[model samples]
Target: MSTGIVLHHLVDSRSQRVLWLLASPLSGEELQIPYTLKIYQRTPTKQAPPELAQVHPLGKSPVITDGDLVVAESGAIVEYLLQKYGNGRFQPPSEGLVKNIYYTHYAEGTLQNLLSNWRIYGMIGERAPWPLTYLSRIIMSKAQHAVLLPTIEASTAMVEKDLEESKTIWFAGGSEPTSADFMMLLPLEILPRAMGERIPKKIKEWVDAAHRRPAYQRALKAGGEYAYAKLLPEASEQ
Candidate 1:
C-alpha cells in the first residue's frame, strides 16, 4: 500500500481530514495514489506522542512524507495531494471557482478558531487553582455564552445557508466532492461534540450525506475509531 506516500495519522485528530482525501474515490480511480497510514496514538493528555516529534519539528499528525519531501498542515497537505494526485479531478482550473480553495483553508482558519479557543480555555480552567477553578469555569462559560457561542451559531448558520444555496451538496458547489469537502469534514464532524443540540439540521444533513459516502465510510474504517463522529457529552473531559 506504499505508493511512497506515508501518512502520519493520529487517532481522532485533524488527521482524519487527510485520511479522507487519501481514501477518497479520486485517490484510487482518478489519481491512483496509494498511501500507508502510520498511526500514532495520543498521550493520555491527548497531545501528540513524543515519538512523533521526530517525524518533523512539531511532530504533528496529518504530516505526510512524499518521497523525500515532508509536508505538514492539513490544508497544505490536502492541496498538495489534490494538485499532485488529483489529476484534474478535484483540482479545478477555473480561478473563478475558488470555493474549493477557500474552504480548504477556511476550515482551519475560521471554524477551528472557535474550537481551539475553547479547548485552550478549558485546559486552562482545568489546571487553574483549586480555589479559583470554579471562578475560571464560570468566566469561560460566560464568555462562551456571550461571545463564542453566538459566533459559533452564526458560523454554523452560515454553513447551513451555504449548503441551501449550493448547486451541489458540498460547500464547493462542485459536481463531485473536492478537497474542500475533506477539509470541511474534520471540523464539522468535530462540531457536534462542541455545539451539541445547537447544531442546525442543515449541517446535520450535510454531515450525514458526507458520512454516507463510500469513500468517507472507508476512510472512517481505516482511520480507526473516531470518537468525534458521535456527539459526546464532554469531549474535553477526555
Candidate 2:
C-alpha cells in the first residue's frame, strides 16, 4: 500500500531506530511502510543541521511526516508507526505489555539521560583549557563516580536480573522483538563501550542478537555510517 511516510534520518542519531522499526519484519512479512529518507548531516560539532528545523521546530532528528501529520521524538515516532501501521505486531501480549510500556519510555526518559550526562561531563573535561584540563578531568571523574555510575550500574543490574528471571532474550519477555527492544537497543548497545564497563553477559548477548538481525543490518546499510554499527568482525566480540 501507499504509506505517505517520510523519515527524516540523521546519521548516528536515534532516528536509526525508527528506520529499523519500520523495516522490521512481523510474522515473516515485511512492514512495507515505504517512505522517503531525507538524510541530514551533523555539523563538525555533531549537532543536527538547521534543515531539520524546517521539518520540526526543534530541528532534531527521529522525525517523520506522514502526509500532513508531523511527528518528532523517537518514542513518539515509534508509537505513531505502531498505532497506524503495526496492526498488532511488534507489541507484546497483555502480560508483557506493562513491561513493554515501561521500557519503551525508560530508554529515553531514564537511560539515555544518564548516558548523556556521562558524555557531557567528559566533554566538559576534554574541552576545558589546558590550564584546567587536569582539574576538570578529576572533577568530572569524581562526578561520574559519585553521581552517574552508581545509578547506571543499578539500572543495568535491574535489567539483567529481569531478563535472567524471565529467561527471555528481549526485555518484554516475548519471543520476537517488541517496541521495547526497538527503544532499548541503542542505550544497551552503547553502554559497555560508552561507559568503559563490562555489561552483564546477558545484556551483551542481547545487543549482539539485535545487531545480528536482518532488519538491523538493513537499517545500517540504508541509514549509512552509523557510529554504532555492529563493530568489525562481529558485534559479539564487543
Candidate 3:
C-alpha cells in the first residue's frame, strides 16, 4: 500500500492518539510512509482551520487522509491505523476480552469531555467578572462536578481496574505497546500536565512510562509547543 497518512493536529486533543500510533513502536522504516501533520493555530477570534473542513465536512481536528481514504473521529482513525499498520499487534488474543475492554476505550471521550467542560467552567469562573460569572460557575458546578464528575470517576475506576487486570505492560495483552495503549495514554498523559495538582501519583507514573517512548517525545516536540504556548504565553513572547 502506497498510502500516506495526514493528521490534523491540535495539541493535547484526540489527534495526539493518531500521532502516537504513527510514531508507535510497531511502525518502522520499512513502512515507506510519508505522513503530513497539519497544525491549526488556536486563537480567540478564529475557529478550526479551513483545511480541516476540506478533509472532513465537520471541520474537526484529528481527521486523516490515507491515499483515497478520508476518516474522521479519533476512534475510527485509531482503528484504521491499527488495522493498516499495526500488523495485529495491539489487539487482545481473546475476542471476549477485546469486546469487554472496547467499551471502556470508547468511554474515554465522555470522560475527557466532562473534564474539559469542568476546566473551561473553572477558567470562566476565575477570570470572568461580576454576577454573570458567578452564576455561570453555579450552573456549571451543578452540571459538571455534581452530575458529570461521578460518571468520570466511575469511568476512571473502570480503566484502573482494566489496567490492573491486564497481565502485560499494555492493556491489550502484549509485552510491548498497542493502539489501545496509545489511545488511552494521550489523555492520561496530558491531564496531569493540564490539571497539575489535581492528578494522582499513580496516573503520573503511567504517563511517565508512556511519555518515555521516542515516538511520544517526537509527537511532543512536533506540536507540544502550541499547548505550552497557551499555558505560558510569556515564554512564547520571550
Candidate 4:
C-alpha cells in the first residue's frame, strides 16, 4: 500500500514509539513511505495544543496520516503500519497461539495499559502538583517493582527466552524487528532514568539491545535527547 506516515512528536511522550517503529525493520528510504514528524511543544499549562484537534477530533499526539486515511491512538497506528507495510516482516506467522498472543492480544491489552500508565505517571510525576502527584508516584512505584518490572524480568530471564521471545531482537517474536518492540521501547528507555536503581537488570539488558540498533540511535539523535531533557527538566542543566 502506498501511504504517507506522519508522526506528531511530543517530547518524551508516546510519539517516540512511532519513531521507533519507523526506524525498525520496515524502515528504509526504499519503502517510499514519506513520514512527517510533527513536533508539538507542551503548553505552559501542561496541556496538549489545541492545534492537535485540527488533525483529529481528539487532538492527541502520535496521530498518523496516510493519504486521506487518518489514524489516532498509538496502538491503532502501529497495527495499521504492521498490516499495511510490515508484509510479515515484523510479525510472526499467524499460525498458532503465540502469534495470536503477540498480535491480537498483546498490543491492545495488559502490556498496553502497563506501558501507558508507566510512561504517564513515571515521567510526569515529578512535575505534577501534590496529591495527584503523590498518588501517581505510589501507583508507579507498585506497578514497576511489583508488576511490570517483574514480568519483564521473568520474560528475559534466559538467553533462550530472549531468543524465542520476539522478532526484531527487541520485544515481538521474530529475528528482525516489529512494532511490538517499538511499543515497549519508549517507556523501557525512560524508566531507568526516572526510577534509577529500581529498574531491573534484565529489562536494562533488553533496552541495551534495542539501543544498540542504528535506527534507534538515529531516532534518539533526531528527537529523543530534546524530549528527555524536556521530560526530566530537573536533571537538565540549568
Winner by lDDT? 2
The predicted structure with the larger TM-score, 2 or 4, is: 2
Q: Tell me the deviation in Å of residue 166 in model 1.
A: 0.5
Question: Over all chains combined, what TM-score does candidate 1 have?
Answer: 0.89
The best-first sequence of candidates by lDDT reads: 2, 1, 3, 4
Per-candidate clashes, comma-separated: 0, 0, 0, 8
Scored by CA lDDT, what does every candidate get?
0.78, 0.82, 0.64, 0.61
- When 2 and 3 are scored with lDDT, the better candidate is 2
| Candidate no. 3 TM-score | 0.79
Q: Return the top candidate by TM-score.
A: 2
TM-score of each: 0.89, 0.92, 0.79, 0.68
Off by over 4 Å in 1: 1-3, 92-96, 232-238
Looking at candidate 2, the ten consecutive residues that score lowest on lDDT are 229-238
As a whole number from 0 to 100, the lDDT of residue 213 in candidate 3 is 70
- The runs of at least 3 residues in candidate 4 whose Cα sits more than 4 Å from the true structure, single-residue gaps closed, are 1-3, 93-100, 103-108, 111-168, 193-195, 224-238
Give the clashing pairs for model 1. none
For model 4, residues 1-238, the per-residue Cα lDDT tens digits are 3356777776556677677777664666646566767788777865778888888999887888887888887778888888888766666444332553453444446544555565565666555677688876776677666766665444334323544554434444455555556666655555544354555445555666666677776777666434442332332222
| lDDT of model number 2 | 0.82
State the lDDT of candidate 1 residue by residue for 169-198, as single tens digits. Answer: 777776667777888887787776468777
Worst 10 residues of 3 by lDDT: 228-237
